[model samples]
Target: MITNFLHDNYKNITRVSILDAKKVFYPMKYVLEKRDILIDDDSALIILPFPEDIKYPSNTKMTDAGMLWDYKVEISINNQSALTENQLMRFLNKKVIVVFHHNDGKIIFGCNEMPLQYGYSEDNSVNPAAHCGYSVECRGNSYYSKVST
Candidate 1:
């Protein structure tokens, strides 16, 4: 049995409300879909799964206000399609909010107040046959919390 549920649909995240970051404002309340992580149950929010390489040894610095953190995530989207490429372009030089849903019902949120800045990097190929698409890197602050769902 094929496990790629989005192989046929091939959708991408074009909106922030896909995961509803508002509901997860606090640590206790949250949401997730681990069993069907890539399943776009809502027609309003068609999302695809991309592997994220979160830079380790996360650095936390002390600031005048309080503590501050810096994070970097490398997302590899493989080859979704040309249409997907167009949609992904909109993220460049933009503030992107990401809700990383874990298998054990936990979510790593790209800070709601200070969303991450996104841009493209290390594009594998331009040749249509071998084109893998952009390797997006999002850098900013983040917080972790348990998923309420």
Candidate 2:
């Protein structure tokens, strides 16, 4: 099971921190491999692989590879320039879901709700991963957007 593997392998190693609310961290190791899948203009369906050295809280258990609980994300984008000084700030108000996928399937991390955004910044630096050329897909949505760090 995922929990068992995480506990036995990454229980004591691997750490992540979000420097900015607009950005999501994608480990450097997977950056190159992730580039190809994310660069497509089409809404790409790709699995997010987690490093074996990362572990979830013991209390949080996964019945399958695609199930995760207690992780929540919110993303907001501004369609109008006058509403917010920074376009990325719009994402602050939107609900977001960080999905993790593996060989099995996709799992929603945090909350399973759709997020709201008023506008989106043309600036790619808003999302670090996207700055590196990775595209992000909203779960279950046909839209494909770029994430700029």
Candidate 3:
């Protein structure tokens, strides 16, 4: 179903590893540009789900590269109380599905599982919501080998 959604909506999606932080922003940037979503607010981060199958580069020292991990996601709007931790966690815990709807009533779903790793305030301060960023780490097994039809 997710695969169908992505195939019907988005043009294409590039899979990037979480360890590859340098390229991680590319998909985010692409989604923002295509959706015309403004990154000025924390809501932008909420629109997209965290990616899965994050592995370190071959040269990295970490041996357990294929293990699956969880992530914490936070979406800060103008008001910090707009969304509570429980609510945020629930949203992030939802199935990793992204459906891109076009004006023509056609939909394309991203054929990828976007799992959240973790979340918290960037400044380490608890206050009104300022920015929404995720603290994601790998979890479980890698799904990179799973093929799609």
Best by lDDT: 1
Residue-wise C-alpha lDDT for candidate 3, range 47-93, written one tens digit per residue: 33222312222121223322232222222222234354444454342
Q: List candidate 2 segments past 4 Å from native.
A: 1-69, 72-90, 110-149
lDDT of each: 0.44, 0.28, 0.28
Return the clash pairs for model 1, or none.
none
> Residue 139 deviation, candidate 3, in Å?
8.2
Worst 10 residues of 2 by lDDT: 136-145
Error of 2 at 31 (Å): 29
The count of backbone overlaps in candidate 1 is 0
Candidate 1 displacement at residue 98 in angstroms: 1.2
lDDT of 3 at 78: 27
Worst 10 residues of 3 by lDDT: 53-62
Q: How large is the C-alpha RMSD of every model relative to the true structure?
A: 9.5, 14.9, 13.1
Best by TM-score: 1
Those runs of model 3 whose alpha carbons end farther than 4 Å from true positions after fitting are: 1-76, 89-115, 122-142, 146-148
lDDT of 2: 0.28
Q: Model 3 clash tally?
A: 22
13-126: candidate 1 lDDT, tens digit per residue: 222222323323422122122222222334212234443333222467765544455766555656557776766665557665454443323234353466667776646765
Arrange candidates, best TM-score first.
1, 3, 2
